[model samples]
Target: MGSPAMADGYINGVPVDCYCTDKQGQRIEVGETICLQVDGRMFMAQCQMSLNVPMWREVSPGCLSSGLTAPLQSVDPSIHTLGVDVEIFATKS
Candidate 1:
């Protein structure tokens, strides 16, 4: 099985202590990008940390391809065109 997004490997000796959890309760390491489906639209989100808070910030308006079973024809218009900034917040443990 393929994942909806790919997790980036750590750079030489660089360590990441922050991470965000997805809707399914999966752990997303900082700097990792993931594809998420919201309301019928596909989006690309990156895990990031802000003020010690872990959050997923939308990096792309739409996802052209996701390894999931969902087809690509399902994405709606640009998320920016909707005048909304999508962000998912997760508590750090």
Candidate 2:
């Protein structure tokens, strides 16, 4: 499962929580997994972020890691305040 990250920010031309950060405190310039916990079920999203605007909403739709590339169920807005480790790339997972 991926870590919990905010969808409303940016790090190095990418969405803050949806991209990888390296030890040099730099954004890895690559896509990453954003995990979402909805109603006790964890879903994964494959993200590729560019700008920090509506793109955050676009690349964050979760899909299964394997079968069926379609998106998972929509996230319930009621479950807010997801606590995740915020780090720049290069930090060990």
Candidate 3:
């Protein structure tokens, strides 16, 4: 709705992406620091949407089948205790 995740108004800017998900595996708002962990290295970015919507449109068309794997953890500023665990990836295009 607002500016898209990337400057060009695209969500899948990188071959890989990260997300902060709730207990039900639903994505929440992008926090102050959304972190992704791949190969034990962490990458951080900002999320642009709220958790109220389903994220079907945000996904890249071929991303899932393109060797994408998620092992992520993101810091939700809304939570005072701990940062939420998220989806990370192994991606190639």
- State which candidate has the highest lDDT: 1
Report the error of model 3 at residue 3, Å.
8.3
| Whole-model Cα lDDT of every candidate shown, in order | 0.67, 0.44, 0.41
Pairs with backbone N, CA or C atoms under 3 Å apart (clashes), candidate 1: none
Q: Write the per-residue lDDT of candidate 2 for residues 1-93, one digit (tens) a residue.
A: 233234445454465444454335555434555554556655554344445432212234455565533333354435642433346334785
The weakest ten consecutive residues by lDDT in model 2 span: 52-61
Candidate 1 vs. true structure, TM-score: 0.48
Candidate 3, 13-77: lDDT as tens digits: 53224445643666655443334444565444444444333232232222223443453234444
lDDT of 1 by residue, 1-93 (tens): 322222232323354455788889988878889888888988999997665567788999887664655543455546433433344344457
Off by over 4 Å in 1: 1-17, 66-93
Sorted on TM-score, highest at the top, how do the candidates line up?
1, 3, 2
Candidate 3 regions exceeding 4 Å error are: 1-26, 30-32, 49-93
For model 2, what is the C-alpha lDDT against the true structure? Answer: 0.44
